[model samples]
Target chain A: MTAQPDQRITISVDAMGGDKGPATVISGMAKSAEKNPELGYILHGPEDELREMIARRRGGQMLLDRISFRDARDVVTMEDKPSHVVRHGKGTSMWSTLESVRLGEAHGAVSCGNTGALMALSMMRLRKLPGVTRPAIAILWPSRNPQGFNVMLDVGADVRADATDLLQFALMGASYARNGLDLPRPRIGLLNVGTEEHKGRSELKKAHEMIESFADRANFEFVGFVEGGDIPGNRTDVIITDGFTGNVAIKTGEGTASLIGDLLREAFRYSPLSRIASVLALTSLKRLQKRIDPRRVNGGVFLGLNGTVVKSHGGADDTGVSAAIKLAFQLAKSDFSEKLAARVASTVELAQDEVHFASATQEKQEGS
Target chain B: MTAQPDQRITISVDAMGGDKGPATVISGMAKSAEKNPELGYILHGPEDELREMIARRRGGQMLLDRISFRDARDVVTMEDKPSHVVRHGKGTSMWSTLESVRLGEAHGAVSCGNTGALMALSMMRLRKLPGVTRPAIAILWPSRNPQGFNVMLDVGADVRADATDLLQFALMGASYARNGLDLPRPRIGLLNVGTEEHKGRSELKKAHEMIESFADRANFEFVGFVEGGDIPGNRTDVIITDGFTGNVAIKTGEGTASLIGDLLREAFRYSPLSRIASVLALTSLKRLQKRIDPRRVNGGVFLGLNGTVVKSHGGADDTGVSAAIKLAFQLAKSDFSEKLAARVASTVELAQDEVHFASATQEKQEGS
Candidate 1:
């Protein structure tokens, strides 16, 4: 788990979990292998099928040498309930993928399966970190920041989060940003309906005070409250909210992006002159697409767990899967999971002290 | 306030409430006057300033003939708290604007003011409809629907909504879509984090059942639960949620759109060839911009109230203000408030009956 330059970082892959099947997964692995020499893989699925798919690739022999296979008989479908999967998914590729991480055979796990099921199995196998009540799913959003992305957490890990849970998210999110994005001191903002002190639900106001109280000790700057508009804006490095709001916000962002993309395509096909202009502007447009492409920011890292798990998009192609792999490699290289755990553990103690202090202050006030 | 072909529709204007000065409001009124000969305005602000601005327009004399002035010396700034404004804001233009509607002097009102203040002032002045506990702010989102937009409600009206409040929102939203958008039977969907039955908060689950129970009687098709993406998607015509989630989703959508637009402009300005292409694509690009322009969908109608109030964006310029005026005119002409009141009143009785029946059923089960 040490970040030694010469240490090999192996990623556990659930090859059969994706919509595009194992070929795309194998191709993504090959792409990752071509870029990094210190990377290895533990491909989880039916061993023979994965072996044949890897052997048929362009640099099949080299890829075969770096990849080891684990035979898993079952494939977790998108429709399978997370609870059902947890009880009966022991033989699945997703389970085996997390098992590799749990057994210390791989540094991290990547799965392009049902998100709910993946999180369920992940929690079942890896368990929650000490004092982590709700594990968060953090994703990188394309932003106008210097790092070119902002991290948002609890994007559908659990539908609810209390004041203390939100404080935990702020600490964990700051840690992820620091290690994963190379920011030494990240600015964290609690997401609310308005930036005003009196707005939003009462939990947000309580969480705001809790997060601010621990900001200095946690090595992150508290930017106070931010709105949904600031999620992709350059105002903050880490945006923290309960899973319900974060999930809706990110999906709404994606839906808006997709709608605009569709509209742009329709505009280009409006006339022959516009079509010609599209051809002329193809390179610039491609550059723009590359900059804002969801594929480039593919992984949703599951934080506050014993091990790291990167949930790739269910419909991800090779390019998308490769992006997830790159993220997993970066996180593993930085030992992000361990760092996040340590950050959360220390903050939990701080949070408890603050709670006790607050009640004691109230008691003194009452006595007076 | 019956819809009559020859009756002139007057919209009360809060001239000093917007980020821009009274000049922008006067210009917007002039634009509306130019388009519709039957539209009149009760301009609320310092009388002399509004008069001078109107007189300075191109068709000064003609415009002045249809406009009336209300002298309110104070202005409500964005920083003003809603509670403070409601208690001490009698002399403000925002209060005067709603006063016109309350006194039946104007058919509807439009203000580009602080949203919280507007809604608070509105509830206090106009009052809520019978059996309506929480009034909602419904806005039109640019979408793929045949009508070109979707209606989402409770977009920061209040921070919270219980199951019954959500049911009222569903009924009110359906009425807005039917009368405002000219849809006879609209489709209503409750917004949640996911489309699954057991995915969101317990209140959402309760709201789902309550909403479904009244769909047929309310004259709208219940599309069940919808995610954040469906806010702008074609699956539903009206999206209903608590103010907190709806507020975040819309702002997130707007932020994502703004980010893509800035990136697109940067791409087009990248090189000389791209600049040439931008020139050629000007018409098409403008067409695209016009299609999704936020100004075109500028008004957020405060539903579940006795009178209709359209809250324009605080930063709205002349075009945006004009759009708000246009919506106010449409709703006034259609007697949208009357129709919505009728819809909610009947649904309220039905809801009471359902409650009684449910209790009766439980009694019968206990007896058995």
Candidate 2:
């Protein structure tokens, strides 16, 4: 269904599993609904507890009126393993949450529970798209681009991905930039150790050529290769790498940013004069903090799945939860799930044939 | 060559190849000499240029008395590839500089040239240590530990490393920590995507058991597996991974740190109030900047080679060049080369055996 400005969009929320419980989740939903009045939500939890909470609403009845309920007997705790969740999670809030998407009762699902569990449940219920080998976790990283962020994929979907998988990531990431970031001609880059013609593992080289071959029909410009140095910059709109490399890169960037932010605070408070300066510069500092805050960039979109599922950070409060909900809303409003499915299904065979032929020829040359 | 306090030590310097030319390299050496007067130098470059530059150095005849010139007709530029350098780099300053260490004319060598070129020349001229299939490039990362830094290796020596290579990195990194950082027993960690017991790829699991078995004889504690979040923190003294992961981690950390640093500066200059605050906080900001400056941590040590070589940044200025020199002198003074060779020679075979045995047992179990 196409998004009409006046038409209401329904979203599914797993309210029982977040760190701050339903209090923060409901508050975040109210804040989001204040700006997006067209939002209707399917709240997943024990209906009795949620009813009491909704009855005690601080805001007017507008937000309360938009919410509906689905009863899930159990909650998926943070300690639950992905395998365990998949095996025995039929009645749980997390499973019930994604079931809404599968049943077409909601456009998408959002959760602030364990990442592995969410991905498992989503993949099991929603299923992988046709021709998709491994689903990827894509997030928008703050960048020097005019759009203020860039797409990096397979952050922690799985630990390993082959050359073909990386090629799929490049295609999916390009589609993400086009639909999510609204870039007309998104540039794709394969992450490697160096930008030179001859560097990194054989898979990266293979993926480089694979991505280059498919750029024209895929409707994205392939910019050869980029290093980790390019991840936070504006040089490329999309970066595709294995889950291991991408995961480590994301955590490393976040760790370094947190360390620098801590040091900056300490430095600004070093002396009385500096303390006064800090007070004067508080607004500017807060602006920078808001711009780079991980809390503001909460959702990790599960790409290549039949239905979109956003995993919010486990410790996310109201603001983080709201940011994640916003991502889910935009994706749902744009009919992103259908667009992504069409993009992958239409182009998969062509990309696969190219890779198979390239590898076969490479094997022949090596044998000779 | 034990570290006797009063003994004079020699350090070889390639006074070419840096972006700023010989002026910054020489100035850095002079600064190091002022702090450590017993540092004798064998400066390599065109004799005419060196003689003119050294004569102009202040503090007069005393510093000059300790300096000697090694005439070289050429310089290895930043654009020079490693293969090209190995073939046509005989007379270049970078080649001549490392040759001095090979011939035992100097204890250690330092160059602010191309990293790929320097590693190529050093490996070719100096050779790998016994039992070492690969040599790693180790760098001192600023950390939350009281020692203020940690060791991470194989930054970019090669794009790939196997289980056996990772074992060697752990040993060599431990030695560098012991000799370079003065840690009696450095804690070594295997870098992976997760800290869970049964996460990440098979090689990581194999390496984990391998490192554990060698800890007693290697004389360093193994911290099992660590994620990228621990890179800047005090979790482990040495983080071991393949060159691709290590290189990306370093670059991603640097990129993120730099982006935050740039944002911090802009925050302090946003308005008139913040501008005044910037003036008042200038000294503190400078202190913080110096604390995390990449120039201050300029050298990446080439470990598991017969002799020590430090790769200063190609874009390093006076201060960066000096930091690299000081590291070389310290390694030389401690006889780091001999210690490293002994460490690798003694420990590599045992770790290799452990990996093979573990894989065999696992395969047998699977068949059963």
TM-score of decoy 2? 0.93
Q: What are the per-residue Cα lDDT tens digits for candidate 2 across A6-32? A: 778888999978889988888888878
Question: What DockQ does candidate 1 score?
Answer: 0.81
Provide the TM-score of the second chain in candidate 1: 0.97
Best by lDDT: 1
Error of 1 at A170 (Å): 0.7
Candidate 2 chain B: worst-modelled 10 consecutive residues by lDDT: B1-10
Off by over 4 Å in 1: A351-368, B355-368
> What is the Å distance of residue B244 in model 1 from its true position?
0.6
Q: Candidate 1 docking category? A: high
Per-residue lDDT of model 1, residues B86-159, tens digit only:
99999999999999999999999999999999999999999999989999999999888999999999899988
RMSD over all Cα atoms, model 1: 2.2
DockQ of the candidate models in sequence: 0.81, 0.69
